[model samples]
Target: MKEHPEGGTAAALLADPRIRRRLPTAGTALGAGLAVWLLGGWRLGLTVAVLVVIGDVVRRSRKTSSVTAWQKSSAAERRTEKQLKSLQRNGYVVLHARAVPRDDDGVSDGRIDHLVIGPSGVYAIDSEKWDKRLPVRTMSHLKLFHGPFNKKDRLDEARWEAQQASSILAARCGFEVPVQPSVAIYGPSIPWKVMRVRDVDVYAGNRARAYLRRRPKILTEGDVERIFEAAQQALPPKYPD
Candidate 1:
């Protein structure tokens, strides 16, 4: 097994050990403050230096290094998987990185991050790790906007994935199976407990277990077993190569 991770972008500015270490970070702030002092005033420069120091402290507290999008997503999945462990103990079945056919969805690459089925019926969950600097909010419960980016396409993709799962399970189980679509986001705080936007449930990634627990439990033990069997066969492991 590999000890180190993969796919991390090395920022040119952040490559220097001087910039990363506390003493050097303080030195850089002092330099900046000195430059500001010449242009503006001493008080203004002091304030700017203090702000820079505080900002660097906060950044180091949050993360030590820069990571690519894939790295962030992989981390988010791991965090969510940890949350799903309790669910597994409670008779729930969780499938990670299952392949769901595009079926002309036009939105996804045929991937369901986590498919959970238990007492709350079925769920197709997509894990997301967005920038914490941006605020996450829903517009009238019909749209989700993260900073300036609209998440309509993502919502649609999740819904389509769940719909495809529902179709496959229904065909094999010989009954209608409704799979709830959801997006479990990490990093940025999700302001709402559970919000339905464009037919997809959205919540914080850490709330994975709690979210299911709060849902209306309608599936019996037998139903969970049968559906789990069907899904295991129908949706192959995405990483099975």
Candidate 2:
């Protein structure tokens, strides 16, 4: 049975400080409607009130979606970071928003969402937030389907990011650093705990911590520290503040 009431999402939204501040007060639409009624007919006044309410709702939705969606994609990373906190005490070191040159052009394509180094070896995890309404399923081990959209490009990108990190870390650390590529999907129900699809690991976001822990510990503590330090220097912060 669910621990909380069924309207938990609605309750959480009502409680969020950011969303609460944006909630329309009682006077807005009513005041506007009254003003219109004084100037025009009741029909016009009703129309004006409806438009005002709709505008307010649309504005709030836009702001919230932008903050939580791809325009501000860091929300997924932050979620995964909290989930991985227990790993710290277990000798795991995590790097967030790390950037490295994608190629000889020296331009950074984008930042890796998370880089994890510790006993389970090095991992480059790409945290994703997809629409919950859409069903995520794989057709064959080679193809991933999100509704009707194929995620071949996304899988390829994840692999490339891991390979890039592996190359840089190996060159800097003077040893082979095989960084495993993985994706932790949020906002949708992933059918599997962990699966290797198109050479990259995929799993539900809730399994982020367990996903890494389930792997055998291949590196000693000393090796972990050296690579963690090297990764810090090699993969500079994408958004240095």
**lDDT of each prediction vs. the true structure?**
0.84, 0.82
Tens digit of per-residue lDDT, candidate 2, span 124-226: 9988889999999997789887889998877877888899899999998899999999999999899888888999999999899999786788999999999
lDDT of model 1, residue 204: 91
Tell me the tens digit of each residue's lDDT in model 1 across 1-241: 6533332334543666754567677898899899999999999999889999999887654442122222333777777776787887777989888888885646887989889999878999998989999999988989899999999998999998999899999998999999999999999988888899999999998887788886677989999999999999999887764
Extract clashing residue pairs from model 2: none
Whole-model lDDT, model 1? 0.84
All candidates: CA RMSD (Å): 10.6, 13.0
What local lDDT score does residue 53 receive in model 2, on the 0 to 100 scale?
81
C-alpha RMSD of candidate 2: 13.0
**Per-residue lDDT for 10 in model 2?**
88
Give Cα distance to truth, residue 161, candidate 2, Å. 0.6
Name model 2 segments beyond 4 Å from true. Answer: 1-73, 103-108
TM-score of each model, paired residue for residue? 0.69, 0.68
Q: C-alpha displacement of 169 in model 2, angstroms?
A: 0.5
